[model samples]
Target: MGKATGFMDFKRQKGKEQPPLQRLKDFGEYTSRLEDEELSKQGARCMDCGTPFCHMGIEIRGMAAGCPIQNVIPEWNDLVYKGQWKEALQRLQMTNNFPEFTGRVCPAPCEGSCTLAISDPAVAIKSIERSIIDKGFENGWITARIPKTRSNYRVAVVGSGPAGLAAADQLNQQGHRVTVLERADRAGGLLMYGIPNMKLDKYIVKRRVDLLAEEGITFLLNTEVGKDITHAQLKETYDAIILCVGSTVQRVLHMEGSDAQGVIPAMDYLNGTTQSLLDGVTAPINTKNKHIIVIGGGDTGADCVATALRQGAKSVHQFGKHPALPKKRAADQPWPADPQVYKLDYAYEEAAAKFGSDPREYCIQTTKIVASSNGKLKELHTIQMDKITNDEGYIYFEEVPGTEKVWPVDFVFVAIGFDGVEQSIGEHFGVKVLNNRLYATMKNYETNTAGVFAAGDARRGQSLIVWAIREGREVAAQVHGFLEEKNIKALA
Candidate 1:
C-alpha cells in the first residue's frame, strides 16, 4: 500500500464528465481526465490486501468476479502513488493489451472485488488505469513492439473487435503473421458502431488500429470470410483460423405487429447512426421529432435512448421486462460478487436531465405494437407484470389484470440481447452450436474443427468487453501452443 492509512485519509474520487446537455451537441468523449496529483491521491487509496482478490479473475455461478484480464491492480496502483507512471503503464499493459478501451468502457469488476469495497468505496482503479495509459500515450512511451523475426506461420482472425484485435496483437508478438478480416467497411466491430462516440470516441479506436497496423498486423476491412472469401480458401491460405465474429444477431419480441416498418434492431439502429456520422450523411435512422420506445433496459437499451435523444427525438421511453434492482447491494449478494445494484448510466442521466424524468419503465411487457395505416409502428400496448416463484425452482411472471396501457411511439428499437452468432459465419466454418444456442468451446476456445478456434461473444455469447479481451488473450496462447507443437513434430 502507498500509505498506511490512505484509504481512511482520502475519499473516493471519480473522473468528471461534461454536462449532459453540452456533450449531446456533438460526438466526442465526455469524461474528463483526472489531474496528475489527483490520480496519485486516488492511487494511494489502494490497500494492497493480503489476498488481493481484485486480480483474481474467477467465474462464480456463471458471472465474472474480478478483472477478467487479471490486471495487476495493486502493483500499478502502488507505482502510480509513487510517481512512477512509466513503470505503472508497463505494469498495466503486462496483462491487458488494450487498457485504453477497457479503461473507458469496462464496468471495472476489479473495483467490485476490491477488499476496501467491503465497507468503504473501492479504489479508483478504472480512473488510475485510464490515467496511466493516457500518460503513456502522451509521453510517447506507448509504441509498437514489432516482432524481430517471423515464424513463417500465417493465422487468420475473423472480426476486428476487441477479441480479434487482442488475438492478432499476441500472435504478431509471437512472430506469426496475423491477418484480421472485418465484415464492416471499417474495423473495431462494436467499438466502431454499437457504442456511441460520446462514450468511446471512434478516433481512439482508430488510434489503436493504426498502431496495430504498424506492428505488422494486416487488417482487411470489408473483406468477410465465407462471403467474400470462401472457407476453403481461408483454410488453404492460413495455417490456423480464429473466429472472433461477435454475436451480431439481435433477439426480437414476438409480439403482435412485430413486423411493422418502424421496428428495428438495436444494433441496426446504432450502426446506421454511426455510419451516417462517419460518412457525414444525414442519419438513416433519425429519431428527430419522433416519440421513440426502446424495449430493454441493459446497456444497449440505454444506448438506444441516448442515441434517440441526441438525434432530437421529441420524447423517449425505455421499457424493461425485469423489475428494477435495489439502489444498494441486496442481502443475498455479498462482496467479491458483482452486485445487482441500480446506478444511473450516462444515457439515462442525459434523458432525465432533458425530459425531467427517468426514461425507464421497469417490469413492463410489450403485449403488442400498434401500427399506422402505412404499417409503421405508432404505439406500444404494454402491461405490468408481477414476479412470482413456483415450486420445482421455476421463476415465472404474470401480467397484472387491468394494467394495460398504450405508449405513443413513432420509432421502436428492440434492444433485447443477442441470441447467438450469425448463422452464416458459423455455418461457413462448420462450428458446433450447443443447447444454449451459443458456439461450443473447449478448454482453450477451440471448436470441433481442427486448426480452427473461436472466442469473444461468438464463443461465450454476448458479454462485457473485458471478457472479450480475456478470451482473445487466452486463444492467442492456445494458437501459439498449437503452432509450437506442430513445429516440434515437423522437426522430429
Candidate 2:
C-alpha cells in the first residue's frame, strides 16, 4: 500500500539467525534484529491485497491459515514501510496485545496465507512485527498507561500465561482491579517455563509482566487458586473470576519401562530446566553427556532436541510414528491453506549441526523403553511403521515386519502431547467440564457458574500462544460487558 511497485521492488529476506553451532552454546536469542533500512525493504514486500487472507483468521485444509489474533497486517506493513514505527506499534496493539510473544514463538501462519505467497515468497511479516515491537522497546515508546478512572470491578485471573496475562492487561485497562494468580514460583506460565529461553527470552516475559504490574494489574505468584488459596475465598473477594489454567497435564506413554526413573515428561524436563536457570540452581534433569531420546516429533520434541544440545548432550534422537513429509505442498493443500510441509525447525538445524545428522526419525515407533541394571533408562525397543487410514478414517499405524531395533539411551523424554486441562480446577471451582474434552468455558467464555469464565487452553484446549492471547482479549471484553450489565441491573 505504501508503494504500488513495492512488492515488485523488494525481495523477501528472513531475519537472520545465528549459526546453530555457535547459538547452541548459550540460551540467548539467536535472531539478529534487522536494521531499519532492511526492515523497511521487507515491509515493502507486502502486496496488501483487497481480500488479504493474512489476517482473516480462517481455517484452511483443517489447519489454521492466518493470524489467529487477526492482526492488521497490511496497515502495519504500510506503516513500517513509511517509517512510521510508533504508529506501526500502535496499529499492532489494536488487535494483538502481545506481538512480542507471537513474533518470536508463533509459526507465522499469516505468511503462509499471504497473497504474495501464492507465487512469490511472502512478506517478512513476522520479522517486521518483531522489529516494530523491538524498536518500540528501544525507543521507550512501550510504557505503562494506567487507567484514570476505576469501574469499581474486581476480577481475579487464574494462570499467568498468555491468556491470563492478556485478560488481566485488558481488564485492568478497562478500569477493573485485576489480579493474576500463578501456581508457579513466578508468573508467565508456559511462557516462563514450557518454552525455551533462546526462542523467547525470559527478560521479555518479565518486562511485560513488570509493565502490567505498573499498570495496576496485580500478580500473585506461588499461590494456586484451588490449593494454597480456597476458591470460596476468591468468590468472596473478587466480583468475577476467569480461569486461564492451560492444559498442564502431559500425555504419558504406556509402554514397558515408561516409568523408568530417567524417563520424564517433556514439560517436566523443560519446566525444571527453566526454573533452575531462573533460580540460579542446577537443573533437576540434565542431558549433559547423556544419550537422550525424545519421543514425539512435534514442537515440544524439537525444543527438547535443542535444549539437550545446549545442555551438552552427547547424542539426541527424536522418534515419531508419522512418515517423512512431502517436499512440496500436496494437492489437497491449496493456497491460503496451512499445509503440513516438510521443514527443518531450529532444533533440527542445531541437531544436524552438532550430531552431523537430523535428530528427527520419522515412521519409527518405540514399542518399549528398557531400563538398565542401575535402574535408569538404558535402551529403547523400536520398529518401523506404515500408516493406514481405514474406512472409518481412524489412522492405524501398521508395523513393518521384522523391523524391530534397539538403541542405547540415558534419558527419555515423553513429548507426545498433553492430556487436557488440569482436573483439580474443576473440583476446586465447581465449574462444568465440556464433553469429549476437558475444557470448562461456556458461550462468551462464561463457565456454568455465574461470575466465572474460562479462556486460553483451559477454555479451548491446547492451542498456539497467539490463540491463547486472542481468547484472553475476547474473554476480557465479555467480562467487561458482564460487569457493566450487572451494574445496570443493580441500578434498575
| Global lDDT of each candidate | 0.90, 0.89
Q: Which ten residues in a row have the lowest lDDT in candidate 1?
A: 57-66
lDDT of 1 by residue, 269-387 (tens): 99899999889999988888999999988999898988898889999999998888998878766778777789888998999889988999988989999898988888889999998
TM-scores, each model vs. reference: 0.98, 0.98
Model 1 misplacement above 4 A: 391-393
Candidate 1 at 86: error in angstroms?
0.5
- Residues forming the 10-long window of minimal summed lDDT in candidate 2: 434-443
Clash statistics: count for each candidate: 0, 0
Query: Model 2, range 1-492, lDDT digits (tens) per residue?
Result: 888898899888988999999998888899867888988888888888999899998787568888988999999999998999999999999998888999999999898899998888889899999999988998999988999999877999999999999999999999999999998888899999999999999999999999999999998999977778988899999999999998888899997898887898998899999889888899998899999999998999889898999999999999988988887777888878866788888999899998898888889988888887778788999999999999998998889999999999999989998877777887788888777356666678888888889899887778899989989999999999999998999999
